[model samples]
Target: MAGSTDVAKVYERFISLVREVHWLNRISDLLSWDQQVMMPPKGVSARSEQYAVLSGLAHDRLAGNEMADLLAHLEAHSDELDEDQRVNVREVRRSHDRARKVPRELIQEIVTTEGLSQKHWLEAKQKDDFSIFAPWLEKMVALKRRVADAIGYEKTPYDPLLDEFEPHTTSEEVAGVLEGLKPALVELVRRIESSSIRPRREILERSFPIAKQEEFGAWIVRLMGFDFEAGRIDRSPHPFCSGANGDVRITTRYKEDYIPASLFGLMHETGHGLYDQGLDPKHEGTPRGFTVSLGVHESQSRLWENLVGRSMHFWRFAFPFLQAF
Candidate 1:
């Protein structure tokens, strides 16, 4: 009984430390979210520095010797934990190992570069000129290549980078999936193009007041099970979902003349918002509380965007509300 109690105590302590790391990451995410959705254009430099410093601090904590010892102890006594505890320890250890491989300075550099690159991307997009962003994009790619090398890959440099967002996945596996899918997708597109049946496309292109669209988008996402009390929607140049459990946020851009742009975008981002808001609060600030991977995350958004939002059944139900607008 005493041995079991000691193990439990050790597990709790490890979890507490993991929670600290989670909080730091959450703060970093909020800073990024603000940079995209709310920060002033002139605030870019200061925000970039803040992002880099927070990123470095988080990396230091995750890769520190204290975390190393705790993870090693938890791994050695993993059998003593329940399934959830065991999984948390396993994931934290994996993250620790990966973080330890890359230098803190490199992590800071990557974060800073990402902030600057995004600013450049926004400018390039506004001007509709790739040349304006080419240099920054090239620099980011090189930095990422360095990151991939630092992390070490068995087959290709891309594998390590892909693994960051999609654990246990390899570039080759993704390529195989895409290769298998391409033929079917191409055939489906061809069939659609050749079909005699056609639907009116003019309705979707009709003018929609931005304010009304915002109201309609809010209503639609509510129907999709997005908790407004725990989440909010805003506008950005591009649509994205951010934040974690209990504070999820989504943003979408509205075109005054295009109804589908903000409407469908809201649906898509709401799908991601639902996933974030639905996470187990008890496991908040832990790996188990997070979505598994970007692919899985994207699946939720696409499912809502395509399988539900774009479906005939949904349009049948939505047409009335849309007409009222």
Candidate 2:
């Protein structure tokens, strides 16, 4: 049996390893954000190599024997640790076990392929050609299937793949929920389509300048509690929120002719940014500090984007400024 001091030392060692892996993942996220937002068109090839190397290094650290031994020891004496330590160990073990089954080479290949595929996707979209991106998309799909097989799923390959984002969840469970919602959603759409009421399109189609749109959106999110000191809002081909520690990046696209596109899009990403910024800073590198699940994250975004951003009361205060801009 390990003494209390010995257990504490082991836990510290485990945390140190966890921190290294966390930092590598965060750095990869930063690079990804740069790739989408700022990287020159010529940098994709080199960036792909960088992503592969980083993915390999991070995978090795998490799935290595040292991490495995630490987890084994801590898990054996889980009673000796507090709630937080135990939770961290359990989550790390879950990831470590899954990662160990997947070859490091496969992980690197997936990362490299992802970078190239994204680049090709953007090009294909710009040129309005699907053929240019189809081959890379196929490669990406095959690689993911390989990963799902490596991880070993019970029902479907998608179960393991979906678990990557929403831990402890299964594709069947997701399908069930979606199926349940589909009926009500279909009914709602049918009602809207058949309704006699028609919205005033001129209000939504009004010419809102892009610069003013940006200004108004920023102002609204600031009031919604997105800390600018720790975050940024930029334009990307698709909207997303990438957050780690104090740095959170939010991106959205602007359509000058469509007022709601950027405004509501920014609101949505800002909702996600707020949730990321609200996480406990002390647990920034550990599972305890991480989000509960993607479902929770999406709830935050949808709550703000639809429940609040679309509310008449919210616009009551916001419309005058919007008109001024």
Where in model 2 is the C-alpha error above 4 Å? none
Give the worst 10-residue stretch by lDDT in candidate 2.
1-10
Candidate of highest lDDT? 2
TM-score of every model versus the real structure:
0.96, 0.97
Query: Roughly what TM-score does model 1 have, to 2 decimal places?
Result: 0.96
Find the 10 residues in a row with the least total lDDT in model 1: 70-79
User: Could you give candidate 2's per-residue lDDT for residues 1-325 as a string of tens digits?
Assistant: 5477788999999999998888888889988999999999899999999999889998998999999999998988888999999999999998999999999999999998988888889989889999999999999989999999999988899999998889999888888999999999999999999999988889888888899889888998899999999999999888899975589999988888897999899999998999999999988899899878888999999999999999999889889888887
- Per-residue alpha-carbon lDDT of model 1 for 143-182, expressed as tens digits? 8888888889899999989988999999999999999999
Model 1 lDDT, residue 289, Cα: 82
Model-by-model lDDT, in order? 0.88, 0.91
